[model samples]
Target: MSNDLFINLFVQITNMKQSFLAIVVMTSLVIVSCKKSATTNTNPQYKALTEAVYASGNIFPKNEYKLTANADGFLLKQIAFEGDIVSKNQMLFQLESATQDARLEAANNIFRQSEANFSDNSPILDELESQLRNARTKLANDSINYQRYKELYERNATTRIDYERAELAYQTSKNDVSARRKAWLRTKNQLYVDLQNSKSNFRVNAREDDNYRIKSFMDGKLYEVYKKQGELVRRGEAIALIGDANEVYAQLAIDESDFVKVKVGQEVLIKIDVYKDKVFKARVSKLYPKLNKADQTFRIDAEFTDEQPNAYYGMTIEANIIISQNPRVLTIPKNYLVGSDSVWIEENGDKKKIKIIKGVENLDMVEVKTGLTEKSVLVLGN
Candidate 1:
């Protein structure tokens, strides 16, 4: 080959090699740019956002109460068992009552005797009444005789001594009648007072006897029975646990930091272990004012607004109380935020950090209230 032709071929090969190298560099730059975009850049968009407070608690029946014994004795009978439905004032237990029975019997006997003594046919009162009657008869006869003797003495037909004696007899009879009547009244009053006192004492004894029985305070279901028949029970010892049969509520414990955000009538979303993956809707019904120092939490009660799960006492639950929500708002990925209230945005083909006004936020997304629009492109921070 000629030297000129060989030189021309070499030049052509060198130019092609340069062109291929340029193409490879451009391809690598494009790939790197795409990767950077995917990892660090996002755009604000309109989306629904919810802000909620997480809480954990258990299911409890309404008006839950512990039934306690009011008297100390051996349990003679247990009329209600666990899981039994009971009505108000229904007897749940009966304690041994021999001592109370004996006392009540004695009181009843005394009451009856006193009642009889207060009656008009009572022997003591009847005797006093008979004495009063006899004294009245004697007074009447002596009065007539005294009046006759006085007239005779005035007309000089009877001696003054006879008239004075007759007057003395009449005065004595009147005094006797007064004494007898006083005695009758005194005895009747004493008997009446005794009857009243005895009746009052009998009633007290009867009430003490009634204490041997343990009765229900309200209509409810018995959740637990602490004592069995033949067990010894003391006054004020828990006998059973009872609560309203048809109503149940969630008792949630909110952290002290989140308690300020909680209020009555707020919507709550609940997840119970028994009903896995199913969410139940409820509303906050109550908020306890006192803080639980042991756990540094406040108690909240929530009632189901929709269908509730079949729940037992102390069933574990997880709840999210909805603090606020935005159905449509400009939002960005949470990690894309730069600092407390700022985000990184792509501006004029360069990365720019800008402050943003925030609204509601959750774990993954944040509602951007101002300083960002749907057209804004957010960049993730390193």
Candidate 2:
């Protein structure tokens, strides 16, 4: 209740408040310091590291082809449909071939007629042969009679007029024989030509018939069907697409910077969207010389070294082209790398930056060729 006592009490309260605030500030500082010390550190270790160039691509059947119609007609039937596995020379389509069939029939009829005319017992040839035989017999008889008449006339045993008649008859018989032989030869040549022409016409019709039936040239699975029954298809119209089902390859595109590093026969790892958890092994089969203008990427084709898993055409694929590898080398998680050749290391409980000689690197790990050892600790952070 005294004035001196009240002043003393106020002084004690103000001092106590100041002391509590000071304690709170010091405790906050200690907590902040402890939180900062919680850093992740990893020691470099020996591991297998691989360097790869990223690429995107798709799976395609080997020797894929589009089937086109060779002749124009209404599609009468589809012998093979999409998803059907067909062999070489297998019929895939049948166009309406009524006109071709008629043509073939007419041609066959003409060929049969020509063949009959050219037969060994043909009437025209037979008549010509009979006339030639008769003429030859007459010529033989006239020649003998002419010889006797000439001898008799020379000896004056017969009149000169009789000998002249005999000679004339002999000459006439010779002319008749020659004329008959020429007629027979002409008939034979004409028949032979007619037969050849008929045979040629028949083949032309047969080829036209073939055009109406579309056949496959390679063994493959028909991936697409472009025409339906009763649809009018023009010549050279694509009717189907086909490719080998068991044989497949990946067509990929890599960045232009990696074009030089990717070579034929290098190993490739392919990951497809459909096969989410599986990784397939493939080898670089071909390298295209030209770059893709749209994406500014180089093209690569790879074949599966192992049996290709059953896959559809044009499936999305992500691939890594392994450029180089280091086995059992000192490596660190790539996340710890700060730059192309630098990493942050912890030395004496403090963060220190060091430049390193780097080798093969991949999506997850980096190979340290020099400037780091198992004793070096790496500070991994964002």
Q: Which runs of model 1 end up more than 4 angstroms from their true locations? A: 1-40, 309-311
TM per model?
Answer: 0.83, 0.80
Per-model CA lDDT versus the true structure: 0.78, 0.78
Q: How accurate is candidate 2 locally (lDDT)?
A: 0.78
- Over 60-82, each residue of candidate 2 has an lDDT whose tens digit, in order, gives 99989998988999999998888
- Model 2, TM vs. native: 0.80
Residue-level lDDT tens digits of model 1 in 76-170: 99898988899999998999999899999999999999988878679888888888999999999999999999999999998899999999999
